[model samples]
Target: MPTLYHAPFSRSTSILALIEELGVADRIDLREVGVARPDGSGGADARNPHPEGKVPYLTHGADHVRERGAIIAYLTDMFPEAGLGRPVGHPQRGAFLSWLFYYQGVMEPVLVLDRAGLEHPILQATFRDRDAVFARLSEALEAGPYLLGAEYSAVDLLLSSPFQWLPDAMPRQPKLQAWIARCAARPALVAVTERERAGLVA
Candidate 1:
């Protein structure tokens, strides 16, 4: 079984939702761990294998996966029957990988910096700003209801996540808001939220 080192209110929450979406909850070992929070209320868990001691770390057999995007990609590909991933030969594979990497490489950093009120020429040059990120999302969403055309995939869950965490940070664009709402309404997300609230997996 794969072991997921998770924290209740961190990025791991998204991974838990993904597991539920994949219907592989029974196949995974969900290990709750302590992660340092913004309020500085928690410390790292000694059992966590992440070098940075972060949540959402996964280990299966001799393989270990870290980072949100990588873990999503790994699990989706591992269980292709779930149909949450665009496999290698699929036409949308490139787009799928691009969205995953974009969230990790661009969207996340820019949003974090913008939220922190940090400004620097280097950051602007590298990842641009939240405007550019949102513009990219809006452009893709305009093409269809979800990030990858009509189908709701892991990328939709991922890209829409930050906005759910910080609703005030979400743009007022109708399409974007609608997409986020759609993702939020997933039963998988609801299950994860309820479990966390009940302290079942926190």
Candidate 2:
């Protein structure tokens, strides 16, 4: 069984939603752990195995996966029957991998910096700005409802998460807003929301 260290209302919540999507919630060992929030409320848990004590950390036997994109890839590959992953031979495999890495390498940093109101030519050159990132997403979403087109995948779960959490920050573009709504309407996300509201999750 895989052990997932999760913190409710945090980025780990996305992993919980993913697990629900993969239909492997019962198979995973979920252990709620404390995480230091941006508001400085929670503290790190000694039991969390993540080196950084981060939520969304997973350990299965000898292997441990960290980061949202990596964990999504890991779990989706582990359960390919869920059809959330594009296997190696699939035509969309490259695009799938690109979206995953893009969330980590680009989108996350840009969102964080933009939230902090930090902007400079150097930062813009590196990760571009929030508008540029959204433009890329908007261009892709214009083709279909999801990032990969005609199918909702892990990348959709990942890229749409930030906006779901901070709806005010979401772009007002029609396609982008519609995409967010589509992802938000997933039954899995509904369950996660209920669990959080019930305080059943940490």
Candidate 3:
């Protein structure tokens, strides 16, 4: 069985949601392993395979996978029957890859910098602005349902994760809000949410 080194409420939470979306919870062994314990005695889990002690890294026998976006692409393609992945020749292939890469290449940095209220001219030029990121998402989601036009792909699982965006600010855009609700409504998310909660306490 593949084992997922997970930390509740971390960036890896999206992978937890993805496994739920794929309906493969039983197939993956999940171990909560990030963040300091409430007692403050625990820090940077010794079991974490990630050099940075990050959550959501996957270990499958001798193989290990890190990073949220790569994990999504790996697992979805591994189980294409779940329909969360756009496999090789699928017409939507290019867009699927683009959306997944955009999460790290653009959105992640924008979220961090904007939250910290720090900026540099080079970052602005390279990553563009948060507005540009939101505009792209808004335009895509304005079309409704999912980023990939009606199909709820793994891209939805990544992009719609509320953890990355602020709670109060997300509601300002109706389309984005609806998209979030749609993602939140998935049975996979519900199950993952429950699992995450249980794991945190355990």
Candidate 4:
């Protein structure tokens, strides 16, 4: 059985939603591994099996996987029946790979900088400026509901998770708001959020 080491309200939520979206919820065992105990103890323990002690670590048989992006890529490959990923020979495969990597590589760092209230030196910044990043994202999302047009991919799961935090951290962009609304309307995402919320309440 594939096991997912996850906490209720962390990046793990995205993985949970992805699993649910792929209809592989039964195939993956979901385990809650708290970052800290109720009495304030540290460490995730043997069950979680992550050196960094982070939530959403995954183990498939003998293979141990950490990091959000790696986990998504692994699951997509593992369950090809889910069709959340582009096949190896498909024309869109490169675009899919680019977007998949972009979620962690570009979007995450940009968000971290935005939240930290730091400004990048104009000449040295890879993305030109914050406005440029938003403009690119807005144009990508404005075309339709999903990053790859109508088809919802694991890339959407990756992108949507961070974007969920955007409105509070960055200046509200209209296109992003609509994009978020579309993502939030997905039944799997709704289920994940509700499950996490109920867990928190309990």
Model 2 regions lying over 4 Å from their true place: none
Candidate 1 lDDT (Cα, 0 to 1): 0.91
**lDDT tens digits, residue span 1-202, model 3:** 8888877766777887788778888888988775665456557879888777777789889998987888998898889999999999999888898999998889878877887798999999999887888889998886658999887989988987844336744645777777888887887778767766676512
Task: Give the alpha carbon lDDT tens digit for every residue of 1-202 in model 1.
Answer: 8999999978889999999999999999988889889998998789888999898899999999999999999999988999899988999999999999999999999988988999999999999898888889999987789999888999999988898789879887888889999999999998899988888892
Q: List all candidate RMSDs to the true structure.
A: 1.0, 1.1, 2.6, 3.2
Candidate 1 vs candidate 4: the lDDT winner is 1
Which candidate number would show the highest lDDT if scored against the true structure?
A: 2
lDDT of 4 by residue, 1-202 (tens): 9899987767888888889888898888888887764447665666667887887799888989887888888888778788897777877778788887776777777777776777858532763455766777777876667888777888877877766645575437767777777777789888888877777411
Candidate 2 lDDT, 24-140, residue by residue in tens: 988999999898988889888899999998878999999999999999999988988999998878899899999999999999999999989998999999999989998999999
Candidate 1 segments exceeding 4 Å error: none
Worst 10 residues of 4 by lDDT: 122-131
Provide the lowest-lDDT 10-residue window in model 1. Answer: 193-202
Clashing pairs in 4: none
Q: lDDT of each prediction vs. the true structure?
A: 0.91, 0.91, 0.80, 0.76
> Poorest 10 consecutive residues of model 3 by lDDT?
162-171
Give the lDDT of residue 113 in candidate 2: 93
Q: How many clashes would you count in candidate 1?
A: 0
